[model samples]
Target: MGRKSSLTDDQWVEIERRHLVDGISINALAQEFGVNESSLRRRIKPNKAEPKKAAKSLQALAEMKVEVDAKAKHFAEQLGALPFAKQQIVSDLARKLTNTSEHMASAAEISAASSHRLSRMANQQLELVDEVDPMKTRAQLESFAALQKLANISGEMPGRLAALSRGQPPEAPPSQEEVDQELALLLGSGGG
Candidate 1:
């Protein structure tokens, strides 16, 4: 003879309700009911109503899609009903704001770079001034004059000073050929 069920018919109905309507998993229900999982599954046989449930779910999804489409169309119609001049003004404002934002960002980057370069140059100049004695101001002025002359001749004084401040050798001056070309241009322009 087969083993008799420990649960009453009412308890079995409750278990089925939990497994289907409450969405309790079969394994969990089996553990709660103190029954073998296989026996619980066999007794429940949930597959019988799957096709009906699936059909209902698909119908609900289709209804929801129809609602969404209707709402979207209504929104589009409302947007289209706006005055053409108002829409044009809004579009133009949006474009101008976007362009202004880009320009501001570019200007900010340039300003930041220029500020950094100026700050570094100022700091270097301060360090140079600190190194010279105040009593030797006249000699210092003469040295500055010579440095300026060298800078003017090579067109690289600022670059060399920057490099020296960073403990680096100044970049090599332009080649003689390049210098000759520049000189030729100046002479040709009658302003040598």
Candidate 2:
């Protein structure tokens, strides 16, 4: 290599998330993050083949769901024959599996809804041809606020899912003081 890159793994991940998920442009991300435009473009190149892959993945998921349902039914039938402790264990596992499946379905719905909303927002913005400052419109501002809220929920979802899988309550949000301290550290470190 000719030289070392200053960006960290987390920064690269954030860059990818902003570009891929938030639909931020490579040019804007490079200027905001002080990175090479070409490098950013290469790193976050869109996967045109993903729709096909996603279709296959969905098929696989459907097959897996059928298998899981069969197994769960078998287990439920056998649950009555097991000892009390084992029955309790099986019951708990079944409950957890059901919860996880529900969560997965909910997440998929949210993701689809978010994609639809984003597309609608993009179309609305494009239709504001006569407006000098489309972004300043009240509807646009409300849309941005709603998107920000969705982003925050999306960011916390993985942690919530993990907690649910572990049969634990989701962790509480950080206190304002804790958030301030973290912000100070980030600022001190130039946001890594």
Q: What is the C-alpha RMSD of each candidate to the true structure, in Å?
A: 22.7, 22.8
Clashes of each: 0, 0
Residues 99-184, candidate 1: write the lDDT tens digits. 98778656655555555555554444444542446334434433443344343443354455557769999878878666556644
Listed in order, each prediction's TM-score against the native is 0.30, 0.28
Please identify model 2 stretches exceeding 4 Å from their true place: 46-192
Instruction: Give every collision pair in model 2.
Output: none
lDDT of each residue in 1-192, candidate 2, tens digit only: 645767898998898767655778879989999989888765555345562453356468878999999998987778878899998887799899999899886886676567566656655644543366544564654444445445444546656767778999998877756654654453343333
lDDT of each: 0.65, 0.67
Number of the top-ranking candidate, with lDDT as the measure:
2
Query: What lDDT score goes with residue 104 in model 2?
Result: 88
